[model samples]
Target: MMHHLLFCILLFPLSQLVCAREEAFAIVIPSSRLQCYFVPVESANHSKLIFDYQVIYGGISESEENFGLAASESYSSLTVAAETLRERLIRLRKQLDASEHFQSSRRVYETRDRMLMESKLSRVNFWSFINLVAMITVAGLQIYMVKSLFEDHSRVGQLLRRTF
Candidate 1:
């Protein structure tokens, strides 16, 4: 299978894919200068309008011949890189399909829900324990307040009555 894949990759014309001459990119707007360019509506569609700023910086030339040459060079390099990436992905996929890790991945995924629920349950139990403690503490405070209020013989109750 590996030999067959290797043979196909070598024989395939993956490098010969037709790519565009120029790549589209976002224009850089300078904060200092703003200008509007008006081209006749007829020429507005993909007009050879290279900005003066691009020319000043020795950027892409407006010559169609040079553009074609650059495009061909870039396309060849890009296709080679793409083919390498595809080959790597194919190899990795094959490795993964044959490995024990892929076989157990489904089981791992299935257990994730149980693990998450257990985590949530633990959090709920903790909060319940905290609430129980808070309730007990509030009950104790309420008992103390009641005792202080109604027990006439108690010093705390006498103090409270005098303060009130």
Candidate 2:
């Protein structure tokens, strides 16, 4: 009897369960200043345009508020005093270019100095120094031999010195 009651209780819940289909509804307001539409509740793409406009054109509202009261000619003069993001970027780019030029010139000079030092080091090695000293010593001995030969008055004496 207990098992039959348990079966009946489980079957009663399964019998009461029902399946339903999804339905959607919409409300349209055909006004420009107060426009509203159905957008996905989880997405923010609908508001991206406003954010982009705010980033690209930041000073529009300020200009309208301050310059709207003045004449059109004066508005241009006022705008000239205020630096926009574009002008700042241009100025920064020029500075960066100048810095790059300076760095390039410095690199060229450093490379030249390094090459000159390397060339000097290669030419003045231990073997070259030794050869230079040996050449000097041999030249001095040749000059001394020529002076002694010229001082000897007779060819016989020069021949004797050469033989010895």
Best by TM-score: 1
- Residues 1-164, model 1: lDDT tens digits: 56434433333322121113244333443333333434343544555544222212322223422434577789999999999999999999989777867668877987998899999999999999999999999999889978778877888788878888
Model 2: how far residue 106 lies from native, Å: 0.5
After superposition, the stretches of candidate 1 with alpha carbons farther than 4 Å from their true spots are 1-106
State the C-alpha lDDT per candidate: 0.61, 0.56
TM-score of 2: 0.31
On residues 1-164, what C-alpha lDDT tens digit does candidate 2 reach at each position? 56444433332222121112222332222222233233343445333221100112112233354534558778786787666756998999999999999999999999999999998888789679999999999999788777767676856558858798
Query: Cα RMSD (Å) per model?
Result: 19.3, 21.3
Give lDDT: candidate 1, residue 3: 46
Q: In model 2, what are the clashing residue pairs, if there are any?
A: none
Candidate 1 lDDT for residue 31? 33
Give the Å shift of residue 19 in candidate 2. 39
